[model samples]
Target: MSVEAKNLTFSYEKETVLRDLSIRVPEGEITVFIGANGCGKSTLLRTMARLIQPEKGAVLLSGKSISELKTKEIAKQLSILPQGPTAPEGLTVEQLVKQGRYPHQSWLKQWSPEDETMVENAMEAAAVTSFRNTPVDDLSGGQRQRAWIAMTLAQGADTLLLDEPTTYLDMAHQIDVLDLLHELNEQEGSTIVMVLHDINLACRYADHLVAMQGKSVFAQGRPEDIVTNDMVKQVFHMNCHIAADPIFDTPMVIPYGKGRKPYGAIAAAEAE
Candidate 1:
């Protein structure tokens, strides 16, 4: 299954955030959206997830307009994790994860063995099984983020949309979360779309990169092909050197700014 945004135009009040944007999300791959702040990356993700309605055009899920589908039906096929999600004060990790099964449940089937299995598997996948009984409020930031991701995984949707899933996370925790998502994509063949602020991480992790600028896609392709020093300068308004990551062998962006000195230069100066 694939998700496509066709000629999408979205606005807040009188100001337009995204205009005439069109892109197709490749199925069974990790796609990352990158841009500077307020470039409408998050807004575009939200629009595709149906969290926000578009002022013009439509989001199509497998050739069908998402607006035409029932809410529960859409939930069964697509799951979304918005930025900075908050749970109720006293909700436990298990309780929150169990909520993901709501779309598959009805009056005739409130709870079932299938629901229990899904929740258990989801917690295991997210590495939050040990904290199942703990209240979400009691968990650390990383733990809580994993708990939330477990809930999204429990939904068993083919397409997953995330907005800044690594916001406020330490470097290690950010990698942990992203590694979990990468595992899910590889194991389950799920389509993953996320808005990310860290361009280097995006380039390292994304199978397909969508770089937005001026409220539209500036470029879209494999990170190796799309990420360039000129593209970085144009999109981010900052000078950067585009190099290959020694580890991932993908495009790496080294930004330039005051007080930012290259390690090799510093070492050379010290030697002199």
Candidate 2:
């Protein structure tokens, strides 16, 4: 299913964070939101997921306004993993994953063998079966993240929205989570949208990139088409040289900062 925001205008009390913004997330693709802090990336994601209503416009899920759908009806189509989700104390991984099946359950229709199979398959797909009986709090950072992802997978949603899925993870763990998301998009044709702080990694994994600046989208398109030096400068307030990655060939941003430059660059500057 596809999600589209139409002329959304939102605010945090008196201050407007997203103003007359619109975006249509391409189905079965990975769309990443990139911007500086407080640029409404997360806010936009929440609005699309129907977690919060926009003040002016509506969020459409597959051409229908989400305001008309029931909460469980929405949950069956989309799953959102908010930033830094916390499990209940002492909740086992399997138990936490079972919670995702709530939308599929009702007074007349109870849990079935299919739900059991789905829960198990989700645990296995997330590679968290080894710790199925373990408490969520006992797992490592990456493992905990995987366990939560398993819950979302169990929800049987075609679209997944993750807000900063890599937050607080080390370099290796960050890539680990993103790689899992990428695999889901490629293998299962799941539509994925996420807010990412790392622009280079965002470019590598995103089929579409939305660059936000001051409550508006600076640009939106394929990474190679829209990610430019001027976009980085205006959106992130940083001067960067955009080049293709050696491995993925996506746009690689090399920011000019306080790091020591190579001797060749220094000598070239002296020649000028």
Clashes of each: 0, 0
Q: lDDT tens digits, residues 169-233, model 2?
A: 99999999999999899999999999999999999999999999989899999999999978998
- Runs in model 1 deviating more than 4 A are 258-272
Q: Give the range of the ten consecutive residues with the poorest summed lDDT in model 1.
A: 262-271
The TM-score between candidate 1 and the true structure equals 0.94
lDDT of 1 by residue, 1-272 (tens): 88999999999988899999999999999999999899999999989988899999999999999999999989999999999999999999999999999999999988999999999999999999998999999998889989998999999899999999999999999998999999999998989999999999999999999999998999999999999878998899886666789998999888864356556764464356
Cα misplacement distance, residue 255 of candidate 2 (Å): 0.5
Candidate 2 local distance difference test against the native: 0.93
Task: Give candidate 1's error at residue 218 in angstroms.
Answer: 0.4
The Cα local distance difference test for each model comes to 0.92, 0.93
Q: What residue pairs clash in candidate 1, if any at all? A: none
Candidates' RMSD to native: 3.2, 2.2
